[model samples]
Target: MDYLDNVARNFTKKYPCYLIPNQSEDKIKAFLTDRVKT
Candidate 1:
């Protein structure tokens, strides 16, 4: 449960767009990675 909760929190914080699907992990990863590049 803790692991799941942490992932949930991280996902939401990193991708606050509620309209996006949670299954889009790759998209989120790319978004965050791009953010780090700047």
Candidate 2:
């Protein structure tokens, strides 16, 4: 969870949109899903 928290923090720094609490969860899930596919 700590690792993911760090990733989320870094990600939000890069993409400010991810800071939206409501959308962040789905966005992060989608991001991880896409990464896994690649």
Candidate 3:
């Protein structure tokens, strides 16, 4: 759905890799947090 698309878009925009569907939410949260630090 749209939420997933938004997450995918934002994740791809901020990170070097596409966020895999199997990735844990904790990992995604950590990744986003890491981005905010830099």
Candidate 4:
């Protein structure tokens, strides 16, 4: 969970403009999936 927290923190810092007002589970899942792939 801490790893994910750091990842999310860096992601938001790097791409603040990419955020959405209503983030969904599916979107979070997809982001994690994509991150895992790389």
Number of colliding residue pairs in model 1: 0
lDDT (Cα) of model 2: 0.71
Q: Residue-pair clashes per candidate, as listed?
A: 0, 0, 0, 0
Task: Give the alpha carbon lDDT tens digit for every residue of 1-38 in model 4.
Answer: 66766766667667666465456333554687688989
Determine which window of 10 residues in candidate 3 has minimal summed lDDT: 17-26
Candidate 2 collision pairs: none
lDDT by residue for model 1 over 1-38, one digit each (tens)?
45444565588777578327755655655665666579
Over all chains combined, what TM-score does candidate 4 have?
Answer: 0.52
TM-score of each: 0.45, 0.49, 0.40, 0.52
Worst 10 residues of 2 by lDDT: 1-10
Q: Judged by TM-score relative to the true structure, which candidate is superior, 1 or 2?
A: 2
- Provide the global lDDT of candidate 3 against the true structure: 0.59
Tens digits of lDDT, candidate 3, 1-38: 45554675676667646545546444666665666679
Could you arrange the candidates by TM-score from highest to lowest? 4, 2, 1, 3
Where model 3 places Cα greater than 4 Å from the true spot, the runs are 1-23
Q: lDDT (0-100) at residue 8 of candidate 3?
A: 51
